[model samples]
Target: MSGAEVAGLIAAIAFLIIACAIALIAIRIGGVTREIKDTVAEVNKSLDAINAEVGPLTHEVEALLTKSNTLLNDVNGKVAAIDPVFTAIGELGESVSDLNTSTRNLASKVTNGAKESGKVAVAAKVSKKALSLLKKKPADQEAVTNGK
Candidate 1:
């Protein structure tokens, strides 16, 4: 073959190879795009299903929250109502403590009074004994004087 014809033939083959590679890359890109579209469609369907399922659950949760709030308020009110009882119990405890203190004071007074009374009784006994000794001594001296 002539040199010009051979060069032209080589150029044509190189251009065919490049065109084939570009076509293959384009086909691969088209396939990836289709897969992405399918994935997006599936995600949209899943989101719709989740929304449908959550609709009733949202209402149920709201109702549960409302009931919980009511119950909490009722508990708070009952606690408020019974708060006075707890206060009264505390006051009663203080009263009992006061009663105990008063009882101790009265007991101390009685004990001190009893101690003083015991001391007075001992003094009276001592005075009576001294008087009896004085009376007997005088009678003996009188008898001795008469005999002399």
Candidate 2:
């Protein structure tokens, strides 16, 4: 074989090898892309499932919040309704306190009156003793003059 023909054959074989390598790389890239696409599809399915489960829960939470607000408003209204009763009770307590003070004053007056009554009793006894002494003094003076 001629040297020029042999060189041409070598070049053709080297080109075939390069082409095979490029084909293998392309195949590998295609396989990686397919795997990425499958993973993305699975992630989308999981997101759809999560959304399905959470949708009802979100609605339930909103309903519970609405009920709670209603209950709070009802409690506030009830508290407001009883405000007058509370005021009346406070007035009653004040009345009781006033009554207690009046009772204490009455007791003190009675105690003072009792002390004064005791003094009056002692004064009456002294007055009676003085009268008896005055009557005897006149009689004794008459007897003394008669004897002279």
Candidate 3:
């Protein structure tokens, strides 16, 4: 072949190889795109199934939360209602303590009074004995004088 024709032929073959490489790249890209589309579809299906299951669970959870709140409120109300009873009990305990203190004070006073009374009784007995002895001495003196 002539030089120019051979060079042209070589150029055409090079262009053809470049075109085939581009085609192969396009085919791989197409395959990747198809896999991506399939994955997206599966994800959408799973999302739909999750939504179907979670919708009722959401309502049930809300109901349970409301019920728990009501129960807590009832318990709080009962605690508030009995608060006065507890206060009264505390007051009663304080009153009983005061009564015990008063009783102790009274007992101490009574014990002191009894001790003073015992002292007075001893003093009276001593005075009575002294007076009786003086009366007997005067009678003895009078009898001796009569005998003389």
RMSD to native for every prediction?
A: 14.2, 15.5, 14.5
Instruction: Return the top candidate by TM-score.
Output: 1
- TM-score to true structure, per model: 0.70, 0.54, 0.63
Question: Tens digit of lDDT per residue, candidate 3, span 1-148?
Answer: 9999999999999999999999999999999999999999999999999999999999999999999999999999999999999999999999999999999999899778868788657767988976765667667757755873
For candidate 2, give the lDDT: 0.91
lDDT values for all models:
0.92, 0.91, 0.92
Model 2, residue 63: distance off in Å is 1.7
Segments in model 3 whose C-alpha atoms lie over 4 Å from true places: 1-14, 112-148
lDDT of 2 by residue, 1-148 (tens): 8999999999999999999999999999999999999999999999999999999999999999999999999999999999999999999999999999999999899778868788657767999977765677666757754873
- lDDT per residue, candidate 1, 64-141, as tens digits? 999999999999999999999999999999999999999999989977886878865776799998776567777775
Going through the candidates in the order shown, the clash numbers are: 0, 0, 0
Supply the global lDDT for candidate 3: 0.92
Poorest stretch of ten by lDDT in candidate 1: 139-148
